[model samples]
Target: MTGTGAALTYTTIAGRHRHEIEVRRSRFIAVLERVESQEQADALLAALRREFHDARHHCSAILIGANREVQRANDDGEPSGTAGAPMLEALTRRETADGRTDLSDVAAVVVRYFGGILLGAGGLVRAYSGSVSQALDTAQYVQRERCGVFQVSAPHATAGRLENDLRGAGLTVRGTTYQPSQVLITVAVADSSAELEVFRERLAGMTAGAADAAHVGCEWVDRV
Candidate 1:
């Protein structure tokens, strides 16, 4: 979580723990899920609230981007820093599931229902933090890759052959557009100029120099 050059791997905690930490008749239920961005975190939080509509508190926190650039936490009316901050910290300390030395964009949400026991400020922190920790223990994660988009254009007659060739060569096809005489194919490749050149050569040869490929912008894609 501290380095600047390491690739990000997604991971969670290893086991589950659920205990009623005293907090003025309220019990915490932490839910952790890997997310790609703040928008996804927001959507999940909204869904959880709706699913558990009668719960008393739905506090949440999210850390996203390669550098963990995007971060947000909400106390949801808990005693100031008691709910959100601790949850964020727990996520930060938790290692990715793959055992890779990479950081990831992740989010965790903790829900609390009043249980009639007062856990005080320290206890509140423990309860909220513990909830996310437990959920992380059982969650699944995958690594994401940052790639570049490329488009290739060829005649309709050669489209099927071109598509099959590209897939056989291990290039990911994002989309394909059909025209009366040609087919436009969109693909994603690793963000390396060398790889692009290789792709071009292979594609040109496959289509007998009848097809030409162009580079588009870069995109963050899920690594398969």
Candidate 2:
């Protein structure tokens, strides 16, 4: 439990959320959506542009990867750093209502309907950042953590009890499968090697060494 797995927790919006604000007669509509990949982010931006073709600018930003290692932003014709940069900053700085921080796998697009009152570069920055912050206020999210995966095999009679014990021991049972002579249980666990060793001991004690789990892979799992 001493690596990134123990140190980082990512925040992700659960679905599409939006906020609209009027500043000096200009309308800024911010749309925030959870996107798993760059392609999806671009597609969503394209759709928003077409959907709001009447808008003057479609400023956008995308944060991808579990660690948010991938990020892309575009002013989309707004002055450099005035629109997209602020929007991205607002997202990266703010946290969800549930308190998760460092938002990732998110795409934010702000469609501006110019009010004819030029909101100079400074004003644009404030408007865009505020627009995203407002949308985040109404968004729902779950915290995500990376976990190692394992598959445990057990006799049919011992499977149910083992599963209950696993859950009781704070392991995430991904799924279960029944075979002709045994049952397979997939579990996702945190990164503590000590905890893993303890789990093996628990398995031995529960089934008298007749059942055990095999390390498989890893994935990002979400929880409230």
Candidate 3:
């Protein structure tokens, strides 16, 4: 599996359970959602807040992008590290919410409304973290693939045939561009150099050595 050219799905813990702990005069509700970007994370948080708008505070934390490019968290009003940090830690625990695995780049938000019970600082940490654990109890997750991007170009006359052949060979076409005399096709191959050789040979044969292809960068793509 290490060098087989197959994309590795990240392993996460499995099970479904929720934990609840009380905080200082507030009850926090944490919901965890696996997301791909800051925008998607924000959208999920917004939706959760709208559903529980009357709550006192809506603290959030998000980690997104293939490289975990964007990471942010807010305490809302609970003492600096009491709310968001704990919630983020809960989400990053590499555990399955349900029975699935391969979780990455996710966001976790904790919503609080005064419960009229002072749970103190220790309680706040436990409560905020517990909320996220609760939401994961029923969440679903899927594996993702890291792919290598490539671009192939050929004369317009051979474009259609080349495209059909590539598809039949199980290559994922990312995008296509048509120019005056040639067609450009962008594709994503599995993340191994060996796979690129196989693709290059097949494409070359399909186009009778007239078409040329080049490699682009690698990107994380949704697994089928």
Candidate 4:
């Protein structure tokens, strides 16, 4: 709930990532995964609990929704504020490659195996925070961008070159469909009038007004 306005883009993990660290002889296994809703986040936590059944603590945090409007955490028997809170901070504070701290749709769980020594409150916070940070370091990142979909129809002879030109102009070419008479190229642009206008103008210039692009709605696209 920290940010307002329509969500245009955000960063998230590409898939599950696991990283383990040892502090004061205790093993902290951190698992980070992409979750789109509360149910998915809960499911991930439940699966981890079952997989690491013998672990001493299964602390977890989840940041779901486009603007990270849903944030939840659980100490799971660990000292208050020592495990889950720090883990959540790691996800919210992570910066994408473009330097945006807008990571969302992520769930993090730290499964701790006791090593016979008790870490102080400060030590525990550092351990959990470091575990998640390390896991993020090794995770593959992707950006979820809101884009307007467009279908551009062109002559079959010019489709290949047109596709390359679109990609070269920094547009996302989702795919191309072949037909007996023409080619249908699907492309995505930022979901804004200004972006769409630019795309149309570019298409006109690229095809000498021979090709036409039709707006085909919008959706969230994943970009690595």
Candidates in order have lDDT scores of 0.74, 0.87, 0.71, 0.91
Off by over 4 Å in 4: 1-4, 155-161, 178-182
102: Cα error in model 2, Å: 2.1
Prediction 4 global C-alpha lDDT: 0.91
Assess candidate 2 and give its TM-score to the true structure.
0.88
- After superposition, which runs of candidate 3 have C-alpha atoms over 4 Å from their true positions? 1-27, 31-53, 96-103
Expressed as tens digits, the lDDT of each residue in 179-206 for candidate 4 is: 9999999998988778888999999999
The alpha-carbon RMSD values of the candidates against the true structure, listed in the order shown, are 4.8, 2.5, 5.6, 3.2
lDDT of 1 by residue, 1-224 (tens): 12357443343222222333334667677766667767878888998899878888899888777667777889998899998999888777776744543445777778789887777889888888887776666565556666678888888887887888899999988999998877899988876667778887888789788777777776766666
| lDDT value for model 3 | 0.71
Clash statistics: count for each candidate: 15, 0, 3, 0
Tens-digit lDDT track of model 3 for 1-224: 12554434443222222234355556666666666677887888789778988988888877665444576888878798988888777666646535443355777777788888877788877887777766665665555567788889988887888888898999998888999978999998877768878988998788778777887777766655
Clashing pairs in 4: none
**How high is the lDDT of residue 194 in model 1?**
79
Deviation in Å, model 3, residue 58 alpha carbon? 1.2
Which model scores highest in TM-score?
Answer: 2
Best candidate (score: lDDT): 4
lDDT-wise, the better of 2 and 3 is: 2
Evaluated against the true structure, the overall lDDT of model 1 is: 0.74
* Model 1 spans with C-alpha error above 4 angstroms: 1-26, 33-40, 97-105
